[model samples]
Target: MTTITFTVSVLCLLPQSALARWACVRACPAACTCTQEKSCSVLCDRSGLAELPKEFPCEASAISLEKNRLKFLSERAFGTLPSLKSLSLDHNNISFITPGAFKGLSNLLELKMAHNDYISYLHTRAFTGLKKLLRLDLSDCNLFSIPDRIFIEQTALKELLCFQNNFRRIPGAIRGMENLTHIYLERNKIEAVAYNSLLGLGSLRYLNLQENRINVIHDNAFQDLLRLENFYLNDNLLSDLPRLAFRGLARLKMLNLGGNQLTNVSKTWFGDLVELEVLYLDRNQLLNIEEGAFENLTSLITLHLNSNNLSTLPFSVFQPIYFLGHLYLFRNPWECDCSLDWLKQWMESYKLVRDIPCAAPPSLAGLDLSQVVFPAVNGTCVEPAELNLTTASSETTATTENRFNSLISKLLQQELREEMGNGTESLRNDTLLDSEEAQLAAGVGGRWTQSVQSLLCFTLTWLLFGPLHLSDAGFWLYCT
Candidate 1:
């Protein structure tokens, strides 16, 4: 019999953004010199000016001087402005900033200086004057390392985003910035959070340590972070997380440990995180989760556990979560046996989950997930709809029977031989040979399996049960 073959064609409809905002094109403020229209803000793209315009004649709050051919900024390059909050100087040709270059724009809040040329030197106290700077984004700027003292005086700074810059370790200067709340140091060359590198940041809430080359964390590396809210350490070289790696983050809210080489979560992995809210552990080589690994996280709201090799979720694995909202558990090699029946209850309750992207077998890729993504599917699958006799008969119809008969005749002539007595003897000399022969005849089930088998068996038995004269008589009598 031919195998049940299927050709699946998937057409995933991507949902584009419905709220794509247009570029903000407000009239320029009366603050700086502009090369464009007096009404529109100037774009000094690749302009080879050594210094900025000292006096801007119109009203503009922001300036974008990206990819310019200026080597340095003169002192007092930025004139006094009553309302300038954002600055974009990314992808420029300059490497040095005079300590007094940004002297007058005290209202500046966000500065983006990403993707610039090699900035091998940053003078001391270069960014000491901005009192209202809240967000300093310096990603992808070229620097081998950073001095820690740049942030010593910016007390009002709340967010320090230095991702994708050149640095091999956590800057020790960041440890003393108490007003800092969130630090995104991912995609850097740092190997570890420096010892006491985060000691005094009492208000620091979120620290993203993802996509780095860190292999290990010294014990008590995070001992003094009492107010940290979220910590992400995914996509690193960590073979194992320390037993108490998160010991002092009592108020920690989220932790991501996916995309690593972690083997399993030791029972003491989450030592003191009582307020943890979300945990992502997918795309790791976790063979098993030890008991009590998540015992203390009563506040966890979401957990991701997709793309592992687990055949089942061990019992009491989620017993501690009474209010868990989403659980991602698909794409693993599940047996689809009675062992997975428990998934039905959790699936029935939650509305959102993880790894639904790779939910069903790729064979059923065309099937709509909304139709079969239910808790009852955790049980055994019903018989294939295409395999039922009535459906197959109706779907294939008369040609199916004709094809089966023709195929069987071809196979019989190729496999069965009357030449050698030994060959026929093997076919006929076995005990229960009659039953085996009947089974062989019945093997080619299709649209008309029973009818063709009946004809073949009746003809063989009629010839066997009577003489030629009697068989001819019986055949003629049956035809009549």
Candidate 2:
């Protein structure tokens, strides 16, 4: 009687949560497994099924139907699971999605339909009721175009991946997705970016448009993306960037323009991109950079100008980018001459890296430019006449002073030789005069004695040596 009473009590409480649990377990498909821990999760992948498994739990929160033979998603296919938050239909043969296929999935936040190569058709209202969708991946879909209204009701969508498509132009289809922050459209057949092609994507922050056949970017092509930060346009056929191509992007921080045929860079191409920090312009045919080209890029940090044909650069060309930290100019034909002197000085002063070799002038060929001294590589061009004028004048004055001193020394030596010769001759003549004068003064001792000495010496010197020695003999006689 107690057991019967307990069974009745259990039946009485089966109408609310217990009844729902019992129904979920009974409704699970034979080919699918359902688990109801926090939320009902279904696993129906690789089931060789031709369609979505029948009898899915009504409150299923996550479902995986990947690797199935399902070819189409018909309308209202998943309408019973209004609580579905994640769906994976990848690796299926799905080629079409009929209108309202996911109409009642109001709480769906993530969808993974990637690797569905046969999926070439999508009805306009296929994703109509997914109001809370946040991420969608449709990569490798082989799509030629997307219907503009396919995401009409996905107001909360934030990220989308459409890589490996054949979009020849920027999709103007997703204009109203204002909340989108990331979009990957790489590896497309895009040939041109028409004006206002990406309109209404104001909240977009990261965009990847690399690996395309894009050759022309019309003016104002990126006009509506005001908050965009990172833009990748590498590996394209772009030969030039039209003025105002990126006019509306003020907060952009990084840009990649590598692998193109750009022959020149102009200041007009980077119109007021003040916040840009990193830039890549390598692998191009750039030959010239006009003066003041980087005057507006005040916040630039790293610059890549490698693999170009730049032969020279002006001193003030990089003066505006005061905060620039790294610069790459390798694999270029740099003429190491007078024009590069200032560049050499600046490189040493900033201690910048030298990653390229000189390709001109035989002496500096194949040499690391930073290791070379500019003045030694190319001699100073100062005029020799002006530099040597003072030295030449001083040397001339020195030569004149030495010649005058030599002449004065020679005159003194000649006078000393003549005085020595006169003294020796006078000593011999004075002895003879003294002997004669003693005899004369003893014989006649007065005015007649002096007269006799003077007369005798004057006559003897005149007879022996003419007028040159007579004046000397007269002085000797007077002394005796």
Candidate 3:
């Protein structure tokens, strides 16, 4: 009787143990592959999935649903995936996301929905429970605007990618994300950067606004981004910039302003970028650059001035940048004149100088500026006559005044000698008393005319030697 009872108890224990083992071993979702190499990962990519899978392994930490046909994300679509850390939904046909669609993904760290061009409507509470999310990619979506407060709960987000969209302006959703470090908004239709549009994002370090329709940037637009480092505004329609557009960005390193309509560069635009290392002004309509436009770029390493309308740069523009490494001046209408002699001299100290082609002075046209030998006239550079006049007018007014006075004295002495030679016989016939009375009367009149003459002299001096000085002999009529 005792043996029979023990046999029955063993049989019952065997069935209970088998049932426990069956419950512990979960099955992978249909049409999905599950692996356990490093962690539980599920891949359902390119599977023609029309909707979210009804079940997923509870231990899945990462899932890839790329290249699928998912049209929308229903509420709580991913039911209670507590261990989910990374989810990829790239290259899908997803168009809408209902509220609380990601509510059960409490531990999701990264969410990628890139390449979904039809994703246009995203509820404000679509990402309600993803509080610990770090990176989110919504690129290649045809989104015109992002609902404000969509990321209000994503407090720990670090990188946000919204490139290749139709956004007309920066989304107001990322205003207070203090921990965000990078923002990629390239390839959009953003027109302008309003003042304080990026306020309160103090920890942001990288911002890309390239390949857009941006034309205007308000003053103090980046004032609150004190720790920003890399900024890209290239490939836009920016013809002008506000005085303080990049204020408070002292830590900036790389700045790209290439492929724009900027005709002139201002010194005040980069007054606070003392830590800048690379600057790009290539492919612009730049005709002039202010003196000292790069005076404060002491840490500059690479500079681009290629494909511009510039003929010559100021001598002192690149003098303060001692550590410059690469300088790109190709495809510019460079006039190889004495004004550019300083550039040739400066290039000798660097080993990576690009060949500058001469675009003026038909004799030097098609010649390399570095190889051209500038003729020296009397131990000074032989510049054109018109260039000489420009240099003289740039001098101080005191120097010009002295030169005018010397010329006037010489002319007056010549006139007096000519008059005396022609009237020598007439003067001898006249009485010495007549000459004395005439001298006394002339002296009195001279005092009265002296003040008036001085005023006229100064005015004529400016008209002759000022910026608008004439190059012809017609100006001598004013002196007569």
Candidate 4:
């Protein structure tokens, strides 16, 4: 019977093309479909196979075993397919990968084991021979933690996408990968980042930590990332920022701090970012902003301050940020009084303000602040300035007179010297001779004309430099 079987196997060989087809059909596993062109491709997707197919073409370059019942990867699982460049085992039940499981594929560049819900651990030497690997997708693998040395041999990896995992802190597994450029850790369980969490990854450029439980970051959290540019911290629970939290990120361009619990915009929060162009501070509890909070952001172009608890802003808060193009201030309790008139003028001149509606003071509740006309003199205060005393009681009177004379000489032109002297006599009585001043100001022009010039000068000064302090209330009252 053995001699007859050998005789029949020899007789079954036909033409060369037919013989090659028969050999390929015999080598293909029952659970996979194999096709051959310049290279071989074996597809074993959704095959209900509990283990990898044992047989494939020797020259196969791409193998897809996705959506299978694979549970484990043993040593030398893929037998020395030296030409294999891409292998995908996505959406499998793979729970473990023993040491030397991927020891033979020397040319593999991409290995996707993502969406394997049962994979929570990896052996230290599971990926020992993949020296040329570039992209590894392990996202959504139910991984709470990864062994640190698992990637110690994958030195050529560039992008590591591990989003939507269960990591409670920034992983220390990426210590030696100097070629890494992008890391996606968003939507994870990471609560904080230590000072040196990212110590040696100097080539990292894009880091996304948004939509996590991150609330605390040490001051030196990103000190080593000298080349980092884009950082996303939105949709978190951060309440306050340390003074030097972002001290080393001078190259950062875009920052998203929206949807947090930050109560104030501190002046030092963005002090180190000189190249920042876009800033998102919307949907926070921000009610206060320190003066010069955005002084160093000279490159800022878009600013979002909507949906906050802000009631008023300093007129010169955005003076240092001269190149801003878009400003969002909607959904705030804006007191559309005299303090906002300058912003209204700015909005008219700049033409980039968006939907900034008022939410306070019954009358201006729903009106768009850009269109609302503000009264010029509403809530305007003229406080009498007192001179600081530095001399003895006997010399105090003479010193006060001398100071008053000097101030008058500086404020009055040559033609108004006589009036300035008369004004000083009236001021000695601690009264502004209002009726006489009104008549003199009327000689120059109408009340409205005089008021417009003085107010324009004050407004220009306030816009150019910060707020101004005058030593005399009569400066404003001179027109009234």
Candidate 5:
């Protein structure tokens, strides 16, 4: 009777708490197992199960019913999982979702449905009560149209990934998901987006319109997203960006315009984005950047202008991005002359490298460019025969600092303050771009000698000694 009293006390204490505890300790799925503490997880990856068993043995918190041969998700299929949170149904043959299929997935936060073959349409309210949902990924699913009313009632949606879909146009009056933050639309056939199609999305932060045939975007097209941060418009056919194209994006950060066939870009293109950082312009045919073209981008970081037909970069080239880091410039026809002397000095003062791969020709292809020196200023170093000897010594002797070394050392400091944010003294192994030193140009540099010899030949031809015979073979021997 005493022992029975103890057992009755435990049972009579509480009923609901005992039932909840029992649900976790039970054994589940034969092909899968759990630890003694009993944390249930389904690892049915790459399994060819046709249909979910009428009764799954163990209760799990996360389910992986992906990579199966299932054709349809029947009503109430996942209704019994009260604690399920994450579900991955990717790469499946699923073609249909009966109403009430996701009946009790209210606690779910992420749902992955990417890379499926036959999910043509979705049942209305299929994911009805998942109020805590944060991400819904349905990319590469061959979708054409989305029922705008499907997500009209969800209040907590944040990120939506729909890249690689065949959407020709967006639906009208898209539901006002006030808390939505990101929307991916890359690789779609979208021709246009209505001015108000993205209305009521005040929290949207990212909008990717890459790889689409989007030629026309009306003014105020993105007037709804006041807090947008990143916008990608690469690989499109845009001729121009309307003056007010980015009117409402005061907090915009990064903008990508590479791979487009644009012939022009103006200071006004970035007028409204005060906080914008990264800007890509690798392949467009930009003819000019007006002196003050980029004066407004104080927060700009890395600027890419590779693979273009740029003849020169203004001295104020770095005036806008005062805090800029990497300047990708390799393929352009860099005329190594007096005009580019500052670039040589700048490279050495900062000890920076030219990560640019010069594609000049077979003779100079793959030539490491950071070591090349621009011509002397006004041909001064070599013509004065008295100065020739010092310049010669400056080229070869120990302790002689070449223009390349000095320039990279000094400029690398300022560029680093801009590259790696403040207070970082330790640098990575990539400190110098391939460890090029200006010393190679200082000692016995054939190019410098050629300049001196030309000046001597013109001036000394009138001298009694006349011009000393110097073969082109000898000139080439000392330079490399």
Candidate 6:
């Protein structure tokens, strides 16, 4: 009888152990993979799931439902995943998110819903329970504007990415999110930056508004972003800016204004950005930069001024930037003359200066300014006689005409030398002139005559009308 009783106890223990093993296997939802080796991680990605799967392991800390066919997220969709810290629903067809959709994800730290192009409407209370959410990605969505209170429960949120959307302006919903650090809104339709758009985001560090239609930025629009560091406004439609548009941003480091319609740089715009390091103003219509425009940027290290319509820069513009390391000045119509003599001297001390190709003074047309040696007369570098026509007196007009002819002769000689170097037979100066003078002389003389006449007309107009008309007439003349 004792042997039989012991055998029965062993049989009962076998069934109980098998039941426990079966329960463990059932904890993971169908077609989902779960692992509890480190922390319960559930992955149902690319599983053809049309809706959120139920019966996720109770201890699940991370879940991925990416690359699914989920269309709508109903209320309490992710029901009470108490230990859930991260959830990814990216690359799905999710369009609507009902109120309280994420109701039970209180401890959720990161949520990704990116690449959901159908997600246009978000209920105000959709993210009602994600209080501890630190990072939220809603990028590449069809969101035109977020509801004002959509982020009311995300007080601990730090990073928000809403790039590649149809947001016409900075959403008012993110105004008071003080703990927010980084905000990316690139590739949007945001037209203007109003004063109150970024009211209370004090802890913000990085803000990207690249590839937008931002034409107007109100003065003091960034007044509340005291701790802001990197600000990118490249590839916009900004032609002019308010004098004090960037006031109160003393801690800003990198400011990018590349690919815009800015005609000139203003001295008053960067008065408070003392700590700025990198500045990008490339790919614009910048014809002139006011003196002392970068005087306050003492700590600047990198400056990009390439791909503009600039013919020359003021000598004092870069004097204050003592720590400049990388200077990009290519693809500009740089006239290599006495005005740019200081740049050659400056380039000697900074070996990393990019090549600047000359665009004027036919003699140095295609030569790099850094490689061209300017002749010094009486211990001073003089502007080429051809470029000094604007100041030529009536008595010197005959001499100016002779110098212009000489310049043309020199250009022809240079072209003949290049041709001879390429194994073509060299021709006499008179022979070349007879053949090429009509073609080259007419083009060169017309340009210089037009330029001089325009310069004289501009000077006379400026003197007669004063500075009021300088904007319309004088600025363009000077730039061209």
lDDT of 4 by residue, 91-180 (tens): 999998988888788999999999999988777787889999998988998888888877888898988989888999887888657888
Q: How much is 290 displaced in model 6, in angstroms?
A: 0.8
Off by over 4 Å in 5: 1-39, 56-59, 170-175, 334-342, 353-480
For residue 425, model 5's alpha carbon misses the true position, in angstroms, by: 84
lDDT (CA) per prediction = 0.65, 0.76, 0.82, 0.77, 0.66, 0.83
- Model 5, position 237, has a per-residue lDDT of 77
Query: Which 10 consecutive residues of model 1 have the lowest summed lDDT?
Result: 15-24
lDDT of 6 by residue, 332-406 (tens): 999888888888878877777768999888878998888767677688876765435434654365554464455
Give the per-residue lDDT of model 3 (tens digit) for 416-450.
54456734455445443334333322332323245
Over 4 Å off, model 1: 1-50, 57-62, 79-84, 335-339, 348-480
Best by lDDT: 6
What's the distance in Å from true for residue 193, model 1?
A: 2.2
Better of 4 and 5 by TM-score: 4
Clashing pairs in 6: none
- Where model 4 places Cα greater than 4 Å from the true spot, the runs are 1-41, 377-480
Q: Which of 3 and 4 is the better model by TM-score?
A: 3
User: Judged by TM-score relative to the true structure, which candidate is superior, 1 or 4?
Assistant: 4
RMSD (Å) of each candidate, 1 decimal: 20.5, 18.4, 14.7, 15.8, 19.2, 15.8
Relative to the true structure, candidate 6 reaches a TM of: 0.76
TM-score of 3: 0.75
